[model samples]
Target: MAPHTRYTRLAEEALSPAHSVIATSQTYDGAAPFPDFPDDDRPAPARSGGERLQVAVTALIVTLPFLALGLAAWLLWGTLIRPTDALLALALYVITGLGVTVGFHRGLTHGGYRAGRPVRIVLAVAGSMSFQGDVIGWVATHRRHHAFTDRPGDPHSPYRYGTHLRGQLRGLAHSHVGWLFRNDPTPVERYAPDLLADRDIRAVSRAFPALCVLTLALPFALGWAIGGTWLHATTALLWAGLVRIALLHHVTWSVNSLCHVVGRRPFRTRRHDRATNLWPLALLSFGESWHNLHHAEPTSARHGVDRGQIDPSAAVIRLLERLGLVRDVRWPSPDRIATHRT
Candidate 1:
């Protein structure tokens, strides 16, 4: 059977229905999810023209900013750093970062809540602006990660190498960014057939290229309009466009690399699930560093359940819930919290 078919048969019962509340923590184990394609290890196909174009543009976007920032730092000695441009980049970073945290991770992949069509579109576009992979692909890969975690099939596990000094360094590199160059592509059909089946989500996935162009161009245009100079446009592109994405990307990826191999496991989970809570990263990672609780209560609307663990993303979700933009939130219950607590 195809991956989707297998997933439907295996995961249908496991998945909480749209907007349904999961009352207990036992669902994750019961719903083992669509198993990885153990027998289907055929070589994947090459990238299409659009994919190649995206790769080229993404590379340019990722590189030119550093060069610009470096030259400005050398020649202008930090004088070129505009307050507005820096603030613009920070604003976009928060918006797009939360888009990934709330929309892509919890709302889509884990089904922690449901949003209306307008809210969904906004979230998708904001996530795309971050220049992460399109929503469809991102959701697929992340869902696969939750299903396998530190086990063999995880796309980017820091523990892939044994825990030794040299091995850990190599694993950190692999988990951080080295996995991008690998040939393996997570099969979307098996992991994210639900998202693929959604017309709105499919449309957003199809618009990733256009969204990338808009995101970069928006900052440049804003700078030019606001400051009225080619230099200001370049500066905006450097800080807000390129730097913002790079910063957010590293922070998000740190959850995969740093959170797993370090920090305190304050919650119980599966036997081999080595995810941990890295408090230092809580603020920057937008609450995603609480990986131990996340793994234990995959559907909980809040990851930072502890008294003082600040979860900005969860706060945003709560604000939206108050505004009636998102509904059926799966906030952790007292019993569920007690069950997972170490």
Candidate 2:
């Protein structure tokens, strides 16, 4: 993490390690360090009235679609999931999933490959559409994750509680989504000094709010043009906009929770990383399921270093490399794979 930007301090302090940092600015907004985790100067700000309203709106957006789908299924014996809706949602999922895995994780956070200006802006904007957070903050939290892994300071480790079933369950919840609401923002300056120096990152960070609206509005417009009706637009908003975002959220969160608790670890990573390969999540997670290898070799472009492990994000990077859109590729080698292989 870079330590250049000065962040604002918060009055109250807590010890929770959160996965998501509050996207207040391109600069790293931090408070004084807590005693629990060293290099833990992250600060989560108090919820403002606008933030509270956004939360309420988000809840409503997620709820109403399910209710409508359920009611239609029960009362009218109708299928709420239309072919177009499914197609749109799937498309959005893949696009935004690549944005997070290929763009945010591999490109920005790990420097698995180097991309040109256009690629960087596109990836950052696409990633922001996933509603994860600003790129700099996301990178900051992720770098912190790599720095700590499953140790005490990890942003969202499933082993934070204990080995017991009760503790595991608590830890899983905390890792999956609980920590997002409960914890404070990470100190970006400490984690992402490189990004702060780039004006490109600052522009993308500032466009976050607009990117969010574009994510939803683009789908709605597509639906309206295709179906030529407000009804189709509504359906698109529900399926492609809200449902896709929520599902991706949980899938990304699952890497923090389920991947840590379940799945097979094929690589010898840092002690106690507990990251694993959940094959079921490979497709949806866009190859992020190869968490063990990711932990073992943080800078490697490809996480699925072995045969038959589908890594879509790596494929994208490979294509971009071929097109000269990305350079300084970090694709894993035979020696690198053997060293990490269990």
Candidate 3:
């Protein structure tokens, strides 16, 4: 059978009622039970001290880069942004963004391809620098997302509030960033057991904090080296380190929020899975906005399967395949693509 068909069958088996019950029963990091909003539109209950702390940290992570955007703007008004700063921001954005798309999401979460031990570890480390989350947790949460999709068990779904206008507005916020504040945790054991079993991946997951620091420090050091000044270093830190992160964060979150609510769905997915192909976000999101097809064939390495749809992540995977860095890629066949079409 084709890889897409095989993966679809496997995913269905994995998300069977028995497995769903077991997954929902377990908790990761001692998180509290996930709230059931239904269509009532009631406010979420109060959080505990630990949950409050988590929320504060998540808020800082979500907001600080946005604040940097304002600061960068102010700086730009007063002083022109250096070409080096712009270049550094672009470089780091592409690196960290591709790491998440290719490494964390496709390779680790969906088994899109297989790479050598060194390649796997490097990719994991690179993805960790994106500041989304630890590799294990990221993979686990995404796997759970695919399993439950837009249903009650989904960790982040824009349809959580129902199909009403008020609910959609609220649900969009919740799915985009508010879900980070919730205490709901996806169990790594249930969702990403293979990553947990891999010693290299475990190591990379554990080093997430250090990688976060490195991500920022590298830009600052490079800016200082290239421009030979503290001003250059500070500006690069703001633009490349913080602003770049903020942009990538919102772009990634848009796939969870706007893509579901807007855009075209050329492919059929599971019931309630309203993932869409958003053209505007294609370049920024590295083709992840071609989400409808992704949901249709969750394990397909290439998401932008149609004509004139640019998929940089798929291009990178093909490059890696040619370089012999990765193998067993699950590229979708034309027949498979046609089969999933609506």
Candidate whose lDDT is highest: 3
Model 3 bad stretches (over 4 Å): 1-18, 22-51
Clash count, one per candidate: 0, 8, 0
Better of 2 and 3 by lDDT: 3
Put the candidates in TM-score order, highest first.
Answer: 3, 1, 2
- Candidate 1, residues 1-342, lDDT tens digits: the string is 632233333333223222223222223332232122222434456888876775676567556655655655674674557898988898888989998998888787777777888898899889988887799999877876776666556678775665667767887888887666555677788677777878998999999989988888989999999899998898888788877877788888899899888899989987668899999999988899998999888877799998999999899999999999988788999888899887
* Model 2, span 1-342: residue lDDT tens: 221111101000111224334232112112212123334344445788976875666556445544655444463354456778779989998888899999888888877777878898889888998988789988888877766566656678776666677777888888887666543456777677677877998899888878888989988998998889998887887788877887888899999999987889888876556788898999889899988888787778898878899999999999998998988787888986888878
lDDT of 3 by residue, 1-342 (tens): 643334334444444334655343333121232337422325555788987886787788899998999998888886788888899999999999999999888787787887888887888888899889899998878877887677767889887767677888888999999888776767788776667767888999999989989999999999899989998899889999999999999999999899888999999987667899999999999999999999998888999999999999999999999999988989999998999888
C-alpha local distance difference test of each model: 0.77, 0.74, 0.82
In model 2, the Cα lDDT at residue 24 comes to 25
Local error of candidate 1 at 137, Å?
0.2
Deviation of model 1 at 216, angstroms: 0.6
